[model samples]
Target: MTDLTIRARIREASNATFLADLDGEAVVYKPVEGERPLWDFPDGTLAGREVAAFLVSEAFGWSVVPPTWLGDGPFGPGMVQRWQDIDPEQDAVDIVAPDVAEAPDSGWLPVLEAIDEHEQPVTLVHEDTEQLRRMAVFDTVVNNADRKGGHVLAMPDGHRYGVDHGLTFHVEHKLRTVLWGWIGEPLTPDELEGVDRVSEALRGDLGRALEEHLTPQEIDTLGARCAALRAVGIFPPPPGHGPAVPWPLF
Candidate 1:
């Protein structure tokens, strides 16, 4: 774990999470407190996600959202991550409730339906589809096995960024996400430009740069994914197995 200074414990919840102003800034914290590890979630396999955070952060020039290892979580060693306000009170838009997907009461299964029910304001100025594509590229680059809708966090500013990278850098081709709005749509010229840049960058120096964060198999998969996207373009058909999207994406 990277070195850190604990400023304060923000709150105590089921996850025993807190907010630390590490190095003089506010960051979200989810500390391990008990033996009940967050073993319920399918992926987001902790250690692997930290590496995924590194790779994705480097791939896109966006702020990387990762958990900081403060100590043991409720079950074992825990981590604190960057905190982002999904909805700011100053804004007229209620990023929660009406817009945000309701939590599944029965369990996590209804999360998908709730996510589908939540309405995302499609304005002329903001284009969510474009944002999803960039994230899709990042997902492919990291070989994120679980690219669920809950992972995709829409910021107040309109940037659609993804989180939860524990199940990343897999050797297999497991790039599942909920942003299939552009499945049949062609990659826009601007979007293609970014893809082209990444494609060229992944060949030599950039690929080498990511070497430390990714394993041999992971790196090879990244290169292959890039080639595949270039040849077939970004959109592809859905998977054959379980829910391709994350459950209860709010």
Candidate 2:
């Protein structure tokens, strides 16, 4: 922990998060000791879930999530992830009023609409990019319950990185996200191949690695989700039972 020094407190987070200089490299650290109790996820498990998400992203070869792991920090044991310096001028997801007229064309997908501060209509939109599609697939596999607009980071090199995965990989079907644009679209050859690779990995090493951080039941569900996605060969919409989108999207 002495190797990592807190550079700043990430006040936007619900739990205590800090930007730490780990041996001169910047990393976002989420301390498990600072976690707030959740009704669903077991106590002190969110940090593990964040690392699990990173593992899944790496195993699937989607590379949607940044490198992350469980580690010791100034606040104690928690998740530490590589800090992605996103382009401030651009966001992969946004909320734009319908009358804004100047919104970008072609690559944008309006996932849902809501009322703005003035009680006017606004639409929640995300870019229709291959990177985002891979992210959506990864979210389905991990059953990410909190994929807000802010979680999708647009990097300087044009790669999109997904962060804030503390609410993921529950045994239940809890895949709420802002990335519903590709629902009902047929999966590409590369996407199908990615699913196959993840399914196989889950049977062996991936499953074993996840066991350290997740319950057996949750790991089983991850395998099941991968198999189902491979069988369908298409991006499926949210199931009828639960809410499909996260609130306070940004």
Candidate 3:
């Protein structure tokens, strides 16, 4: 076990978040005691949910979410995750509101159009990349409730990392995200294979690991989602009633 030590506090987060060192490695720490209570999720369970997201990502053989684990920190028990340094110059996912008459050529997918502060129309756009598509698939399987654009981290090496996965794995459906570009698209053969791997893992080791963090019902529902997605073989559309997109998208 690595010895984790708090180095600094991250003030930008809604809840208490810390920057720490684990066995000489830099990591972000989110203590359960510092988590704000949510009406939907049980009290002090957000940290566990974050780790659960990591476990699911690893199971899929998709390193979309950063490496995370449950451990003791300066603030008590919490989730510790390896820090990913994002490239400042380029963003894998970005918002573009070009003032041109017609939309730009290709590579971008329009998410929504809104009126700017100047009353001019603006269009929100994200890159059409395989990395982002994988993340969207991961979000669906994990039942990620909050997938704001800001949560996507673009590495200098072209790899994308996702963070802040505290709201996930609800027994009831809850998948709020900004990645609607691939909605209704058929899952690739590799993606389907990943889903199958997860389904099998959930019946064994992954299930046991999650049981320590989540309720039995939540784990069961997670397996059911895997089966349903495999059966459908298509990216699902947002539910009819609730909000499918997250607020403050970036």
Candidate 4:
């Protein structure tokens, strides 16, 4: 659906969430509070979080969750979004085992590893590593600050999808995530094509419409990321360094 076409009723949600029902379908919402421990962060973090997820999803032509509406919030009126039905067991695929610790590579590990809560296991099995790498690219493009191990999900059919984008789009370059499989590797030809399609889409009406919701700096940064990815021909080296990987999956 178009970004503007998603309709959901805004209900009362906790600081971490803005509750809403998507088109009278299942429940759909986004966390209102950007990320916990907000002392050192940026503005519009809450909105930026959801927007970043949607932007990345659209750019890559995936079913990325979108913010449906806007309403009054603890900080003020913010965007409303459709909530994803995360089956605790089914959704998570990359989280590593916690109690038993790191065993053989037969299980999923936490791909997004910095979340405050514990709901899924994040591990890096041999099969899921490549998908994790692709997700890392999407995270970098959006500047998502919180790509915890548990945020990456495995659909029943084994397709991986990234979620929980509440900390994104800071003025700073604080891109953190757990998928380090491609740190030194280059982008594949198909991956490069995906980046080009996204870049082209951004320059069209989609980017102009998104500009209304995103700040000038944020929008420009999005463009810059697309351009950079197209030219890099490879993943390139990590620019700023804090931690390329996320926290412990287990």
Candidate 5:
């Protein structure tokens, strides 16, 4: 890999994230040294988790996650992913006024209704598309703990990519996201096949690849999650014990 030249710090990110130029191409780097220790996750593991998520995405062959890998950066060893050119006019997920959300051809499905800072009612919604639906399924397989609207990148060609996957692959049922519009809906035949691919790969090369990033227990639980999803064959409901969506939905 080409040496990364730091361009700017992404200050809005919770961890030390940087915009870098890799051989004239832009990329995002999240160094392990800058990761804030989480109460539940072990220190220095977040970078590995990011790579692990990418690996799982590849196993599913959905291109849901961008090309990601571990590399040395200005800050040190970290997770590095190719930057995506997002479309400013597109949003795979969004928050809209209730009236707009209720339009017959809005092309969005409501996930949650809430009050904004102006004391106005708004609805959390996502595009009703097979692309976004695949992402929702991908999130479930990875046990994504935070799937904020901003993490979803909408490309000009209509492809959707998911980023910020550090808080994922937990053994616990910590699934949380704004992509709950398909709750209880049966998985399409293609979706089921995707899940089956992950499950089969887990028992072979994919599981072995993940050992570099996740613990044996975490990998096992990931496989279990895949098997369960395949057996149930539906988008799961939000967990009862915790907030179903991440704070600051975007």
Candidate 6:
């Protein structure tokens, strides 16, 4: 692995994150030593989860996550992912006033309604696009527990990329996310095919690759999630026991 030179710290991130120069390209580096222990997730495993998510995204062939790998950085071993240059004018997911959400040409699907600061009504919505729908399916297969709106990067050419995947791949059901707009909708053929590809890959090389990052049980559960999606052929409904979406939606 090439040495990553620290450029700056990403203070907004919950875990210790940094912007670093890997060769001549910019990348986001989250060192294992900087990980905060979570009661549910094993300590120092968040970096591995990020790498695992990237591998699964690649297997799906959707580019939902940027290129990511586990490598040694200035701080120590960590997850390094290519940095995305997002478009400021576009938002794949957003919070908008009810009237904007109600517009027929708005091209957004309302997921939730709530009062904003100043006691105003607002709707949590995301664009009705195939890219986002693919991401939703990817999240489901990985059992992502923290898919915040801010995590979806809207690129200049309109490609959507997701980040912050530390909370994922639990042995149990823990799918909490903001991309519930397609709940109960039948899966498109392309989406189903992607799931099928992942399911098949899990039985061979992909499964072996993930063993470096995930436990045997977690990997098994991941395969089961893929099978369940293939069986249902629909976007899954949110969990009945826990909160359906992550807080601070944006």
Candidate 2 ranges with C-alpha deviation above 4 Å: 99-104
Kindly provide the TM-score of model 4 when superposed on the true structure, using C-alpha atoms: 0.68
Error of 3 at 221 (Å): 0.7
Listed per model in order, the count of residue pairs whose N, CA or C atoms clash below 3 Å is: 18, 0, 0, 30, 0, 0
Best by lDDT: 6
In model 5, the runs with Cα more than 4 Å from the true position are: none
Q: Which of candidates 1 and 6 reaches a greater lDDT?
A: 6
Mark the 10 consecutive residues where model 4 has the least summed lDDT: 1-10
In order of appearance, the predictions have TM-scores of 0.62, 0.95, 0.94, 0.68, 0.98, 0.98
RMSD for each model, in Å, please? 8.1, 1.7, 1.9, 6.3, 1.1, 1.0
Cα shift from native, residue 18, model 6 (Å): 0.2
**C-alpha displacement of 185 in model 6, angstroms?**
0.6
Candidate 4: tens digits of C-alpha lDDT, residues 7-29: 44343322444344344654344
For residues 176-210, could you state the per-residue lDDT of candidate 1 as single tens digits? Answer: 56554455556666656655666676776667765
Task: List the candidate 6 regions with Cα displacement exceeding 4 Å.
Answer: none
Instruction: Give the total clashing residue pairs for model 5.
Output: 0
Candidate 6 lDDT score relative to the true structure? 0.94
By the lDDT metric, which is better: model 2 or model 3?
2
RMSD after Cα superposition, model 6:
1.0
Model 5 Cα lDDT, one tens digit per residue, 34-56: 99999977733899999999999
Per-residue lDDT tens digits of candidate 6, residues 64-169? 9999999998889999999999999999999899999999899999999999888999999999999999999999999999999999999999899999999999
Quote the lDDT for 151 in model 6. 97
Query: Per-residue alpha-carbon lDDT of model 2 for 1-250, expressed as tens digits?
Result: 6698899999999999999999889999999898999999873388898988888888879789999998998779989999988899988998876754236564678888788789988888888889999999888888899999999999888899999998988888898999998889999998888888888888888889988888888888888989888888899998988889988788
